[model samples]
Each structure stands twice: as structure tokens, then as C-alpha cells.
Target: MLNYLGDKKDERMKMRNRYRKSTALRCDAGSRCLISVVIGSLMGCILLLNLYSAIRPADEIGQHIHLRTSHHLHFPELEEVEEENIQIPPPRKRSPRATKRRPKKTTTLIDEFLDEDSQIRHKFFPDQKTSIDPMITGNDSMFYYPGRVWLDTEGNPIQAHGGGVLFDERSETYYWYGEYKDGPTYHAHKKGAARVDIIGVGCYSSKDLWTWKNEGIVLTAEETDETHDLHKSNVLERPKVIYNSRTRKYVMWMHIDDVNYTKASVGVAISDYPTGPFDYLYSKRPHGCDSRDMTIFKDDDGTAYLIYSSEDNSELHVGSLSEDYLDVTNVARRILIGQHREAPALFKHQGTYYMVTSGCTGWAPNEALTHAAESIMGPWETMGNPCMGGNKMFRLATFFSQSTFVLPVPSYPNLFIFMADRWNPADLRDSRYLWLPLMVGGLVDEPLDYNFGFPLWSRVSIYWHRKWRLPQGWNSLK
Candidate 1:
């Protein structure tokens, strides 16, 4: 009986051992299967990632095509880049006074442009005899000779420098307003930059933009009132005008400062007519901040805003004006902080607001940068310079001009006249106007972060041209 019981025990032990071996085999097989599944999933995922990477660039191109189709037409002539290969002559000897005033970065071409004794002075600042005389331009009536003297209907050179053009619906005429710097240029102090005394804002009237008629001084200076903001010893620059429909008034805003630019403020003026004897109002710091190099932009919905360089010219301030377009409404926001930019030119295209600004080099020209925003008030994004078509130097120096205003073409979308001041520091009265075709479309080479490095804003291109004209039938088309 004991031997039998012992044999039963051994049999039970053998059965237990067999069960344990089978369970171990099953667990090993399951582990192998899970490993295989994980490897397969990883391989498939890698293949999918590779395919996506390969197709994404083409998809981006397709998206660009889709965008272009939505924006409508493509204008090649407006973007045609006229290459300027100006032979930069060798630097000439300068006197102690010249070297002390002019910095080392002053290129030979800039020297020529600024030199009163330069042999090629006429090349940059052409004499009045070769002016685009509207009286004699019978066949060449509409042609624009850029950088040359532009004459008005009364046989006088147009005095509108740093100008903005306004199309009046009531009178069916375009009124151009700007600084009338027809006075002599001189430095106020030994360290001061070249400037002209306050000569008031000049107004010009035009049916065709090419043929402007002088509308006399719309806003004059305060000659007797020495403490007044518009005093002749003070500074007035970059005068911009907008029509207020509710008030039926023409409102103007300008940068008001002292000779040393210490009293930085914005002056306001208003008139009952487009060709106005605008009443000079007081000057004040918009939003109670120092304002300089300023411009006022009126929106489509009658909301007007002021944009100016503030904080001792270290940044920019933007704020909305009141209902009457005379005062700030406390709806203010600062933008482009730490970017030392001035000479702002603001315009909107297809629901996007754009501004062109230059470096603060006083009268000397510098590179231009374009900032964009969806709203007029806050969070502006810089998208690089808008200048194109010139050589490296010309583009770097903004075609040797500073931005003043961007005049939209009423007849065509995405086409604008980029009005700039080719400041003749030696003679402010001889300052030339640089109006070029500004196009606001096309994909830029530099990719932005949003939309997967796609173009967030349309490229702002200010094409360089030696001579050009408005598109055919531009005025008539409107």
C-alpha cells in the first residue's frame, strides 16, 4: 500500500511539471508576438512620416497657388524691377567740418547726392529747366519723370514734400497735402541736422494726379507767437490729412517739435473744404506721450487712428482718434517697441494694415522695414523691407529716400504710389519726391512661423524706377 501511494504522488508531481512547462511556452510566444506587432507598427509609422515629409512641400506650393487665385490679378509691370547700377565714385577729400558733420558710412553716391559742389549734382537734383513742365508736356503730359523737378499748373515747382494725396468724392479732385519746405536749409545748432524753418503745410489740387495745381498754403506758421507750437522756430513735418464725413471737415495731423526736437507733440488742424485754409488747433502729446514722426490713418468705417514714434524715438505708439477726429479716445496701444523706426507710411490692403518705416538717421536715408497688423491698434508684425529692384546699395538705402506716405490707387487694388522724400539736406527746397509703384502681393522667400512657415502677409514690394507713370486710364477708370 505504501509503494502504491508513493507512485500516485510521483504521477501528480509529473502532471504539475507538465502544466508549468506549457504555461511558460505560451507566455514566451505571446511576448514574441507583441514584439513583432510593436516593430511592425513602428515601421509603418516611419513610412507614413516619410511620405508626409515628401508631400508637404508640394502641398505648400499648391496652397500658394490657391491663395494667388483668390487675390485676383497679377501685375508684372508694377513689379518690374528696374536695376540701378550707379557707379559709386571714389570718395573725395573732405574738410574738417564735413567729416565732423557727416559720418563714416556716408557712401560716395550719398556724398554726391548731398554735395552742393558735386559735379554730378544735376544728376540727382536736376535743374528747373529740365522740369516736367505741364505746359510744355503736351505729348508727354502724363509721363512722370521721377527725381526730376515736377511743375504745377502755375509754372512753379510743386512745394509738397513728404506729401499725402486725398481723393475728395464731393469735388472729384485729389487734394495733396504736405510740408511746404520752400525755404532755405540750415542747421539750427552746431550739432543739429539740416532743416527748414516752419513754412506751413502746402496744398495742391489735381484732377489728374500728374497735373497738380497749387492750392496755396493750407496751414501757415505762427510767426509772432514764439511759444506757440507752430512757431517758425519749432518743427512741423509729415502732415497727413483725412476727411471726416460726420463733421464734413478736412482734418490734418502733423509732428510738432522744437528745433532740438525736445517738445515732441502732434498738432491738429481742420478745414471746411479740401482746398483749405485749415484752422490751426493746439498741439498735444497723444495719449499723453511724446509724439514724433507721426501720421493719421482714417479707416473704412470712419475710425481714424494716429501712429507716431514715441519714447524718445525708441518705439511707436498707435491710438484711435475721437469721433470728431480731433482727440485721442484712450484706445491706445504701443507697437514695434525697441525698433528705432521713423517716417511711417500707413495703408491698408484687403483687411490687412501695413506700415513702411525707416531707420532714424536724421536726414540721411536708410533701409526700410514693413510692419503689418490685422487690426489698426495693436500687435504689429514686421515682415522685412518692402524695397526691391534696385541694386544692393539702392535697396539698402531705400532708393535714397525716406518713406512719407503710401497713396493707394483708387482704380486698382494692390497698387499704390509710395511717396518718399529724397531729402536734399543742403537745400531743403530742392528736395525731390520719389513716387514708385508699390505692390502688395506675391509670396516672399522668407517663410513666417504661422501656417507652417507659409506667407502670413502679402509681400509689400516698392519697385524702383527711373521714370514711370500711373496705370493707363487709372483716373478715368475710377
Candidate 2:
């Protein structure tokens, strides 16, 4: 009996050992399977995230949510396409003496535009009877009638031409700086371009951009110094001002040239106040290159850049400014090479940089091309003309205007005021301001040269309007 009990216990012990081994193996297999599943899921999620990032638009990837929303908003009123069909009248009979002085050639709409005696001159330059007098309290109080005479608070025509707006945060006012070309216009020589003697840079202050209060000639011409850069015989155009926080100074940059336009250089000036008696510092060719048709852009980080037409206006050169905002740095890059462009007006949206430039067609208006880059110092890609809502000829001629500065409307993301000069070569002081709506949103109309199967940036559209105003409650947002 004892022997039989011992055998049974031994067999039961053996069976229990085998059962424990099997249970241990099963638990090991289950743990391994769970770990594999977790690892696979994690890998799959990472792969999807990489794919999404790769497909997303570069400009949109790191953009702010509010900016994205603002850009996508449908501003139908501002974007409304208004067509203008201007009919060129038949040529008037000229006297034999007049015909002998000037031979008649193929006359296009542009030809009529340059002619001071054009039969449709009234169409381009409306008489003073239709002037935008801000002092007048009526239905036209704040409405902007583009192409009409814009009078200051004193009832004189605003002399800010080829100008730029500087928002002074401390005073919360907009200071407009430009060539104060209020003098008589004439050609320096028989073969020279139409010009007005330097009267120094004009500054105008405004709470609302429509109603300007003249700040007088902030930077006065050097009357006695014939060799001065600001001498009456010299040329000073496109004066842009930006405030430097570090230096606590308002710095101005302008295109300074001789009467023959042979000395293409940039002049620098500094002011203690926004409405300034700016002190003229000096002038130099930036990067040792002949610079003209220049503009200064102050970036969000307080860094500033100078962009100018170089290589005899065959290309554009961009360089950073010294910390003092007084001079250009050694870092420079040539952009839009061999593509003769001038009248550069640059603005940033989201993470992309955009520039509106005109062909090097002297004072006459030409097609405006918009270029974009991921960087400011760029390998810029031309995005074709941004003009919209005009007739074919109007669009082709940039609405008979040249870009000077692009002002971003406060509190309105992606919405900017396209400030251009409808230059009257015959009378530079009579130049009209074309402040139209410029928006950045839709895909580019023209395929880029190196987009690699996807569009790189948003389309820049400057909508044309015979007359347009900012949306209601624009100032309230500020």
C-alpha cells in the first residue's frame, strides 16, 4: 500500500511540472505579440505624420491659426472684379509745325497715356472739381476716389508721391514719406527724363489714411551746397522710413541720383521724430553696385533689409542693414537676374516673402510681376502679373500705375493697401495715388519654374477698382 501511494504522487508531480512549463511559454508568446503590435502602431503613426508634413504647403505648415483663418476668409466686396473699358478717341489733327516737330507713329493706349494733350486726358486725370477734400463733411467724407486729386487738411493736393507709410507705434499715427515733388516739372536736357528739382522728402501724418495732414518738408534740400546729395539739381525719389527700436531713431532710405541718373546710389537720413527735420547722413552705392528704385523693409525681428535695382536695373540686389539701420551689411544676394525689374515693393505674408516689381520701362507703367520666396534673400520665382479686375490693356499696364509701397492694413491679415503711383510724366506733382486692395490667398496662376509638381506659394492679387474704400469698421479693429 505504501509503494502504490509513492508512485501516484511522483506521477502527479511530473504532470504539474509539464503544465507549469506550458503556461510560462504561453505567457511569453502573448507578451511578445503585444509588444509587436504596439511597435507597429507607433511606426505607422510616425510614417503618416511625415507624409502629411511632406504634402502640406511650406507656407502653411508653421503659420499661425488666426493668420490662416484670415487669409481664407472670402472678402467678396474687396475682391469684386470691376472692369474698365476705356475707349481711345480718334487722333486730333495736328498743325504742320507740330507735325514737323514730332512725327506720328503707331498710337496705342499707352501712347495716349503719355501724351499731355490726349483727348481722353480728363479720363486719366480728373479735374480739381472732383478732388477728395477730407475737410468736406458729407457722404464723401471717408470714401476714396482713386485717380482724383487728394487734398490735405489745408486743401492743397497731397505731395506724397513714390511714398511709403510708416506706422509709429508710440504715437499711433501713420507717417507718409515721399518725394515732395510740388515744384514745376521739366526735362533737365533734351534727352533726359522728366523730373522735378529736389525739394526734399515730404512727410504727412494721418489718423485715417484718407485724410492726411501735411508735415511739411521733413528733409529739406541743400539750397547752397551744389555738390550735396539733396541739392535741387540732384534726384531724390522713393523715400521710405522705418523706426529703429535700438537706436530710437527714425531712419529713411531713398534713391539718390544725379540729373543724368548716372550716379545711382541710396541716401540715408535719420530723424528724432516721426514728423521730422531728418538729418541727411550720406549716400553710397550699396554693395558697391549702382542702386536705384530702392525700398527698405523692416522685418518682424527688428532686422531691416534694403532691396534695390542693380546691374543697370538688369537685376535686383538684397542686403541686410547694420544694427543701427543706417547702412547695408556685407551679406548681399542678387535676385531676379537678367530679368530687368524696378520699382520693387516688398511685403510678407505668413512665412512667404512677396515682392511686386515693375519692368524697367522708365517712368511709363508696365506689367507688374509678383515674385515669392521662402526667404527674403531669395532665389525668387516670378508669379506673373498680379493685376486683376481691369480690361486687358489696363491689366497689361498695371492699371497705368507703378508700385511704390505695399501697406498692410492694421488688424486685417493678408489684406494690404496696394499703394502705386499713376505718374503724370508731364506734371509729376499731379501724380495720382492708386490705393487698391491687395490680397494673398489663391494658388498662383502661373506654374513655377521649379515647384516640383506642387505650387509653392499663394497668389498675390491686386484688385483694380475705379473707386474703393476699406471695409466698414476697419479702424475700429485697431
Candidate 3:
């Protein structure tokens, strides 16, 4: 009876050992299964992320496409616009000399600025009253007195007219460059339009967007040399700059033509420095085609492209610049053909390309059109004028100005500074700069083929304000 009891006990112990081994194996299998599932999930998520980035448009297009310039600009790229940085200074105190004497009948500054015959005309022009004094404190502190003669740090009127701004990141400063129209303005031919002798490109730098220091004429026209491409009598308007990382040089492109604008070609210039005496290389009909009213855009990935109104102002051509950022590559595509558009200011929001253009009218305000494209090349869709808030006349007239440039305020989303020129054809020197608030919002007024039934982009509206500054926080981020 004792032996039989002992055998039964041994059998029970073996059974218990077997059960323990089985439980341990099961736990190991479960852990392996869980690890496999976790790894698979992680890999799947990474794949989806890559695919999403590939499809996202905004990821591809950067802040407003950067215009051409001659500097290693390292300004941080902005994705949205905020209110402008406008700090109004305190009122000015009368100088002791002026306080000691009876104030000559206080003619209003605006009246004196507008009156061509006023004795203070010189004050508003080349004289001291309206002269842009960088050293002046008080009301003039960091104020852009529009229509007032803006003097450089050298106390000379900055010659950058119809110009564009290039934010240089490397130096943490902004460079203002444009046509230096210093020469006298006159009619080119018996029936030709009024024009000034080409004076090349003017460069100015500003830390605070208001106070500008002149860098001098970076590209000066050939004064007495008629054979030169930049001959003083020739046409050189709307000079734009871009940096070419490949070539390691600043490339400039401008609208080069004769007195009658018969030489319908784009001129190219190069400089090693931002403030430069650029070397005029040559002019060309880009892609073996006529180009006018042209501008260049540099992408975030270092790829640059050019857009020009071509085929007798009936269409536009867009082509990518070579890797070196100088000449146009063989790749060329025609967009907005037969659209009869000019004065294009292109910007990109959320990977979508947006452009503002005016009709082919000469020196007269006409209806403006805003266009968009998924790609920079072809099939651009027209989405009517983006002008809003103003009366019908203001919307149709682009606030009585022509599109020059759309400056983006860093801190504001969908808000931009619409810069235009209210050209005084009778007196070009008296031309006024019209800057309005441009906001992109609401369903587009028109339908697009790509958008199916609903509009793909928000409507673009330029609000007309008699006097306005960028909304609060526009430049606060900077």
C-alpha cells in the first residue's frame, strides 16, 4: 500500500511540471506576436506619412516665390502673413529757429506735397522739409512717407522705382532694388510714351523696414556708350534679382528694350555681391520667344523659374531656370495663353500658385484678374478679381493702381500688402504708391474644372482703404 501511494505522487508531480512548461511557452509566443504587430504598425504609419507628404501641395510650394536678387539672403521663409509693424512716432517739436519766428502761414503738408506751383514744391521734391532724413527723430521715425521724397542715408532720393524687396537672411537685413530712374523723363519718340534714361539698378538696405540706407547704383547704365546694352537712352525697367546657389552668384534680369520697346527681350546681369556693379551679360528672347513684363521666382528647393508675358501680350510663358540659376532651361511651358495679361505679381500659398495680373491697358486702370494653378506650367485657372470691400468702381479699378508687387507680412495668414502704382501719366514724377490690404478668403466667385462643383481656392480680395497700415502683428514674428 505504501509503494502504490508513492508512485501516484510521482505521476502528479510530472503532470504539474508539464503544465508549467506549457504556460511558459504560451507566454513567449504571445509576446512575439505582440512585438510583430507593433513593428508592422510603426512601419505602416511611416509609409502613409511619406505618401501624404508627396501629395500635399503646400509642402511643395514655399512662401511667396522669392524674386531674383544679388545676395546670399538667408531671411527666414514665411508661410503666412500677419499685421504690419507700424509704430507711429510721437509728434515733432518745432525747432528753436522756427519757434523764434512767426510760423510762416502753416500750409498743410499734404497740400504743399500735391501743389506743383507751391514754393514748398522743392520741399516735397529735392528740398529739406519732405526730405527722407534717416537721422530725424520724432514723427519721421521709421515712417514710410509715401509720395514724399525718400532720401537714402546719403540724403538722396532712393532711385528704386517699380522695385521689389529681397530679404537677405545671411545678414538679417532687407534689400530694396529697382530701376534707378534718376535721369529726366521725356517722350521717347514723336508718338512714343514718356520714359527716363536708364540708370541701372539701385540698392538700399533697411533693418527696420522704414529707414533705408542707399547702397548706390548697383548696375549703372552706360551713359555715353550707345553700343552698350545698358545705354542710358534704352529702356531698363522692373529690375529683379535672384540668388543662384549652383553658380554662387547673384543673377539679375530686367525688361530690356529700345525707346519704342521694339527690343522685346529680357536682359541678364550678374554680380558677386548684393551691392554691386553688375556685369550685363546679354539679352534674349527666352525659349526663342518674345518676352515682356517678366519676373523670376526662386523656389525653396533652390529651383528657380521665370514667367513672362509673351506672343504679343496675348499669352504667358513659364520656364524653369537651370540649376545654375542663370539661363532658362530647355523645359518651357505656355500658361494663360491668349489671356492678354500683364503686370503679374505671383505668390504661393499652401502649395498652390497664385498670380495677380492687369489688362493690357497703358497707364490706365482696368479690371484685375487673379489666377491659380496646381503646377507652375500649364492649365492655369482664372478666378476673377480678388478685390473686395471697395465699391464696384474700386474693385474694377484695382484701387486706382496697377499691380507691382504683393508683399507678404510674416505674421498674418491670408493677408498681404498689395503694392501698386497710381501712375500719374501727366506727371510721372508725381505718381502715387497705392498699398491696400489683400485678403484671400471665401469660396471663389467662379468655377474651376479641377474643383468639380465647389471652388478649390478662397476668393482674393483687395480692400480699398484711403489710408491703412498692415494689421497688428503682421511683422511681429520677424
Candidate 4:
């Protein structure tokens, strides 16, 4: 009886141990178990991802290889990574007496960029005669020269700056709208920022994103009415458009300010068609707050929102527009406060919201920041600089360009086009567009987060290239 009882007790002990082991794995593993599991899962995922990525084309390398394999469409040469090793020439000698009277100061490349009569002026503002005219350029049809002057089908230089593109599904075309700064550039006062009179917003239509056809000045500035919000003496910049399916209206939202930038407001205009002489309606401080350097985003749903720099551009605010896409609703949420970020370009991917913003420096290139949020409204996290593959200085200065827009490549999950302006402050009309490839993937280079051991965000990379073109079969990239 004693032996049987001992056997039963031994069996019960084994059962108890098994139950305890399953319930509290930490007891045997010392809490390192969870981390081990995580790491193991991560490594397994990495292996699988690497295997799949090795087989996939167009994504592994920056070039679009998948399109070439299937469709056999001939695209311009995929721009190779070219680096610039420009050196600053020595300063000119001045007479000692003249130097004593007026000190000979050191000048930087930035100073050269801001000086209209600098000896290197041609380097920045190349002659428009050698422009990218798609009509006559046979083999170079889709080639994009980063700083070269770009012309439309009408043989006129494209005037769309600080622009946003809208893919019109109904018409099966893309409509791009932006500030039409075709007139001369000037400053309102000695200390004022570089200004271009409100000549109005220009629109361009394209079957492909390349080779635009000018739609003329869709929204004209008020030439006579001085009190008008769009008066020639005032400011109208960064115009973005979105179509409302519910209202069937193409609504425009732009930064409308006075010459001194004291009246910081957003103007609303609407038309029934994409190409239009839009009817200017009114301007207002959205949510009873100052708005500037703004952009409009349409969500996967019909809901659209306007995001702008507020609190004197120290922070940004996002609020949904009314169903008609005319004005802001009462609900407004502040984001990236005290970050001193401006020129927000927002886009969404796989239900996560992402934004690219520049510093508050006027007409100067600064480091670009990419932010991600689970929700569109709040608690956003900075994902560090999205620039990669350039020299350290090039990455830091955003390739000498400021964020204007982040365009998504349809059907291509992580591929995007980073559109920016290489502003020529001396003559804003000579500003050039910088279109670079932006991709989001891989472990970020920066330390992920202080609160956690690894980064929660993916690295956003903008590859630097002298000339690049979209893969011929971008839409069908599987």
C-alpha cells in the first residue's frame, strides 16, 4: 500500500510541475524567455523576408526590374547614383585699405546660392533653352533631370511650384495644381521673405504623371481689387486640390496671407471640373487659429483633412473638412507641437499616416523629418531623416531642397516620389523641382526609441540621383 501511495504521489508531482511550467514560463526562463521568443520570431521573419525579397525585382534594387521582365516597355535609363564633389573657390582679394574700410567676409555655397550675380549663377539657374521638352526628346522621353528646366506640351516652362497632384479616376488622368509664380520675384520690404505676387494657381493635366499639358491659370489673382484675399500684393502659395465624390466638386485649399504675413488664413475655392477657372469663395483662420504652409489630404474614406503650421508655425494642427470639402469642422487636434516644423506633406500607407516636413527656415534647405502615427490625429512619432545614399551633408540638407509633396506610387506599397523645391531665393521664379525616389523599408539607421530597445518605425530613404524616371510599368508592379 505504501509503494502504491508513493507512485501516486510521484505522478501527482509530475502533473503539478507540468501545469506550473505551462502557466508561468518566466519561472524556468527568468523573464528572458519573452525576449528570446521575440528575437527568434524576428529572425525567422527576417529570413523569410530576405528569401522573398531576393526573388522580388524593382524593390530589392532601386531600379524597376519587375516591369522590364513582364511588359518589356523601354524606359529611360534608371538614374545611377551620382555624387557631386563641388569645391568652393577661394575668395577674391580686396585692397587692404578697402578691407579695412569694409571687412572681406567668408562666403559659403549657400551665400552663392542666394546671390543673384554670383559667378556660379549658371550652375544653379541653368538656361531654360536646354529644357526637358518631352515633345522633341525621342529616346529621353521620360527622363527627369533633377534641376533642369521642365516644359509642358505647349513648349512653355511648367509654372507649377509647391504643387500637389490628383489622380482623377473618372477621367483617367492626373491634375496638378500649384502656385503660378510666372511673374518676377520681389520682396515686399527689406526684412520680408522672398515674395512673388499672387499671379494665381496654375493647373496641368497629364495622362501619365510625366509630360503635363498646361490647363492655364485655373484660379486667377485679383488684379484690381486691393481688398481681395488673392490681390496681387498679397500671398497665395502651396495650392493643393482634392475631388469630393459626395459633392462632385474639385475643392482647392491654399495659404492666403497679407504681404506682411500677418493675416494667416486659408482660402477655399471650388469648381465642378478639374480644369477650371475656379470660383474663389472666402478665406478664414481654420478652427480660429493661424494657418500657413498648409496641405490637404483625402483619406481612404471620403473624409478629407487640412493640416497646417499654426502657433506661429511652432506646431502643426490637423482638422477634418466638412463633407462638402469647403471648410474645417470644429474638431481640431494639434500634432508635432514645439517641433518648429513646416511645409507638411502628408500621405497614408496601410492605415498608417506619414508626413514629411521641413524646418522653419525661409527659402532655405534643412534636414527633413518623417513622422508616423497610428491614427491621423495625434501621438505621432518622428522617424528621423528619410534621406539616404547621399553624402552626410547632402542627407543633412535634404539634397538642398525643401519638402513640397510626398506622392504615392499606386500599387507599389512602399515606393514614393519625394517632390521638393530647390528654391533660388534671389529669383524665386528660377526655382527648380527635385524629384527623388523615396522608399520606406528596412531597419532604420538611427536608434529606434529610447523607451524601447528597437525602433518602432521603418527607415524612410530618399535616394539621390542626377536623373531618374518612373518604371514604364509602375502601375502594374506586382
TM-score of each: 0.83, 0.84, 0.69, 0.82
Candidate 2: Cα lDDT at 218 = 97
Which residue ranges in model 4 land beyond 4 Å of their true spot?
1-80, 100-105, 448-450, 476-478
In angstroms, the error of model 4 at 9 is: 67
**What lDDT would each prediction earn against the true structure?**
0.82, 0.87, 0.68, 0.80
Residue-wise lDDT of candidate 4 within 147-241, one digit each (tens)?
Answer: 78988998888888998988888888889898888888787899999888999999999876778999999999899999999999999989999
RMSD of each: 17.8, 19.3, 23.4, 12.8
- Tens-digit per-residue lDDT, 1-478, candidate 3: 2221245457446544643433233347659888778869997997787577447776242331222111112212221322222222333578879867956445443333344565544432344465557777775465444445566777776667666777766676777788776656688668988777787788998876567888988998888889777898888877788777667688888888888777888988999877877898999888777787878877767788888888788878788988876688877766665579988888776567789999987766778999988788756888888776445655676755688777766655566777676554545654555556676654566766333343455567676554344443445336
Q: How many residue pairs clash (N, CA or C atoms closer than 3 angstroms) in each of the candidate models, in the order given?
A: 0, 0, 22, 1
Cα RMSD (Å) between model 2 and the true structure? Answer: 19.3
Write candidate 1's Cα lDDT for 248-305 as tens digits: 9999999889998888999899999988899988888877688889888988898999
Model 2: which residue pairs collide? none
Q: Summing lDDT over every window of 10 consecutive residues in candidate 2, give the lowest-scoring window.
A: 18-27
User: In candidate 3, where is summed lDDT lowest over 10 consecutive residues?
Assistant: 64-73
Evaluated at residue 355, the lDDT of candidate 2 is 98
Number of clashing pairs, model 4? 1
